[model samples]
Target: MDIAALQRWLQHAMTIEARTSKGIIRFQHGSDYRRFLLRLKQNASSNTLKSVKPIPLIRGISCQLPAGLSLEAFQGQVWLEKDCKISVRPSPYKAKTMDNGIPWGVQHIRAPQAWGTTTGYRVKVGVIDTGIDFQHPDLQHSLLRGINLIHRGRPPRDDNGHGTHIAGTIAAANGMHGMIGVAPRALIAPVKAFDHNGSAFVSDIILGIEWCVRNKMDIINMSFGMRNRSKALLSAVINAYNAGVIIVASAGNDGKRRTVDYPARYPQTISVGATNRLRRIAPFSNRGAYIDIYAPGDKIMSAWLKGHYNEMSGTSMATSHVSGAIALLLSLNPGLPPAEIKAVLKRSMQPLRSNKARRTIGELDVWRMLQAAEKR
Candidate 1:
């Protein structure tokens, strides 16, 4: 079935379940599960319910139905399933020249000033993106064992340069050869949810989040978004937030003033917009009251594929900065919950010089944030 049509059907099916079911139907192992599957197959009047896979993380199921089929007729058959549309890709970014020493973004956020207190030692950040260049020298020591959801039982290696770039910005080592990141000593667990083309299913992302939480990651960096909201995705985000895992997401590159992207649009996420070295919001950044903070994203330098370095500009890069900053905070106060960490981040923000009216959204000041954390 075409993705768009499948998405519509899933949305309608979920709505019907929400209106009629007593609560979310939780599946169990053994005979009950087998019986449920058997019943599902038996109820497939048109044989459209090809597969009904369970996603235990969100306590939902992914139903595969035929395209253009009206879900209204089968509402009673799949009342327990809350399926959603799939596929969201990483934001578009620009490539620029390479640089040495601390990247301008790292300096702009004042991450160096916080290093004296904590270099995010041992803090684990879960990066849900294309994956990482595990062989990159700068990122070699900074990486921990991570999963490749796209390919089971394989390393989460980067084929596309996006995830490696994001990882480099978050925790590339402070070695002699390359640029350092915001939290140079922090550990990253690369979760390969998106593929080489940067596209990923919503179900894959939900699975990535479940992996991060179960593995006890201190933070999650989601540098992607979908314009339409997914109830299933939101449920996963909420579960991660309640598990004390801070999630930082990109506002998007739509260049709109009114709204940002889903996952980031969710209240549980620390939504981020892109800013340039001029301390002004990047023209490509999606800005709105929903954006929690801004960070250096324009022409930011970091690691790429093949142990090389490249510069990329997007809210994705900006989100990495925030994630690294959170690592610094968590390294200092390991017990701080997601809400309090977000509060400290907001409390230490510096007002942007470009837009006076946008008092609600400001640039991230890692040094200031760490100082505030120290006092608390």
Candidate 2:
């Protein structure tokens, strides 16, 4: 299982699909590669690194998944471990960043369509990530009381630029005054869990969920993820779901044909995938049963620090769009329960097939979602 040949084979297979999301491929190459992979696994020791002998490095990416069950996919691409399984991590946020300056992503707009109806209805949305820059003119306007849950004894400043980009997508100010968020009227309750590294632990995320439940945040947006599955994170999400808060998360960036990242893949969580302006899923967006919705993510331009903006992309950004949409729905019907909100979102889904839209989890008709909530 040569990594270069596998990538080439995967690339060739991907081109066959009429629908391509950000260059991801489903392995139509049959079991030949799988058989080769099996052989590699059989010869490998407790150390797949020793079995492979040499590890090829992906330029600019300093991270590596261990050999063995974790790096199985890496066999074909020197980047992967020798026939080993890998825990998912970081996601395409780093990979997409490498693409820098692709025009496919533009700044998300603040939802005037939503504000014209309800003024956020006294609801609050919690953003679990690096702390928000409360002083930023665009975000400060709608930010509520935020918490720094990082136990590292440092303030939640977004040095990695991941949190800032996500915040802009969820609730940037409306109008040409700045980039508009999906739900302009919604207030964001910032929860600083990930530090400047754009990484956080499951324990920290669960703790953030508890904080959200305590603070009564109506909706929670989690744009970060861990590679390993944790019972703690799942329990916390279930608890939050029971507490009447809507949680939206990214599907992850593993680039795998079938597997999904946890939290997003958590059965009840509303896992989101990324789509471009055309509404087609992004290539890096992980797909499978867990994916529930799609939104603009590829090459998206959003608020960045230092009075700037960036063209960032990931399912994380896509999750923010869905969160913003939830915020809009919440604004229209302020008292809607969490389950009711989920139901309305499902009912109002317009269907993924559209002319303007090339792809979608399903079309979510915001106006219709609000109408249903009103009747309920």
Candidate 3:
């Protein structure tokens, strides 16, 4: 978009923005971060906080945490003996199309609906998770240059199946087999921050978000989350939003009801909950004030290990579905801003349940969202 138009859109969004979900917090030692959060119930302000835990190595090797706590908190914390440093060197490689992996969601893609009238733009979407399988047949054409924000080494290439799977969901092509993506023409800028264990440092994801801003990606798909909140992480989202990037993230699989998952729960970020095949919300899909919309997440079909496709379930999958949809939206009109994209998603959403202040949003209707955007 041009300078004057960008300024006008920003000015408009500043006036109509809605309130953000609160009670955000973060802690690592995993399952134990909950009670530790209770200590800060009275002062959940975005201030410095701490939690201390014994490292188990020496039976009493302890680490200190932030100041206050008390409000449900984190899960999935682990201890690895190796201490490694990953670097941030740009990659010189470019992707080449292969013939093995199949498209994951082509049949239901909405891109063709607007084919006759649009320029069919290629949007830049950043996938900040495990590395993507750049050479996968279904993804190569849509893949673009990316950054490694996790291990100082190289974005730990998809030793784990998580990142690759999510990438396929966002931009995989449709000609071959598998299912198709919502936006097959979108370009992917993969940024890896987590290793196979689905584990990562808070600082790593922070660097990933910054990479998205500096690169000026149109959308960022974050399929990971922490039950804990970090000022640094939240700031990164705000910075990226101001620059026009839509941040979509998984509503952490905390198994709790109506909870706040960092990055996903961040005010500027879009949080996605999971739904099963029957169009019902997944029972284990975490819920809370932060959830912006729910999508088909259970047994979701997408690309996986060794350039193959399979079904997996998680809020992660749901997040990518929405990201892919956004890509389709941008493909139709390159002029939409991040905030306006959020508005389009919210307005197109059907009411799931109504609270005094707001109604929970459910699965997205891709065609409806695009139709609404065009009319707007």
Error of 3 at 376 (Å): 2.1
Clashes of each: 0, 24, 31
State residue 130's C-alpha deviation in candidate 1, in Å.
Answer: 0.4
- Kindly indicate the candidate among 2 and 3 with the higher TM-score: 3
Tens digit per residue, CA lDDT, model 2, 236-310: 687788777899888886655466677787866787777766556667878755677666677776777765666
**Candidate 1 structure quality by residue, lDDT tens digits, 1-376:** 1333433455455444233221233333334445554555565563334434456677655554333344453343333333433333343544444556788899999999888889999999999998999888889899998999889899999888889999999999955867789999999999998888888777778889999999999999999888877776888899999999999999998899989988999999999999998899999999988999999989888988887777778899999999999999899899799888888988889999864547766899998998888776
Models sorted by lDDT, best on top:
1, 3, 2
List model 3 lDDT by residue over 203-227, tens digit each. Answer: 5666677777777788999887765
**Model 3: per-residue Cα lDDT at residue 254:** 60
TM-score of 2: 0.67
Of 1 and 3, the candidate ahead on TM-score is: 1
Give the best candidate by lDDT: 1
User: Model 2's lDDT to the true fold?
Assistant: 0.60
Model 3 ranges with Cα > 4 A deviation: 1-120, 151-156, 351-360
lDDT of 2 at 151: 52
TM-score of 1: 0.84
Top candidate by TM-score: 1
As for lDDT, the candidate ahead, 2 or 3, is 3
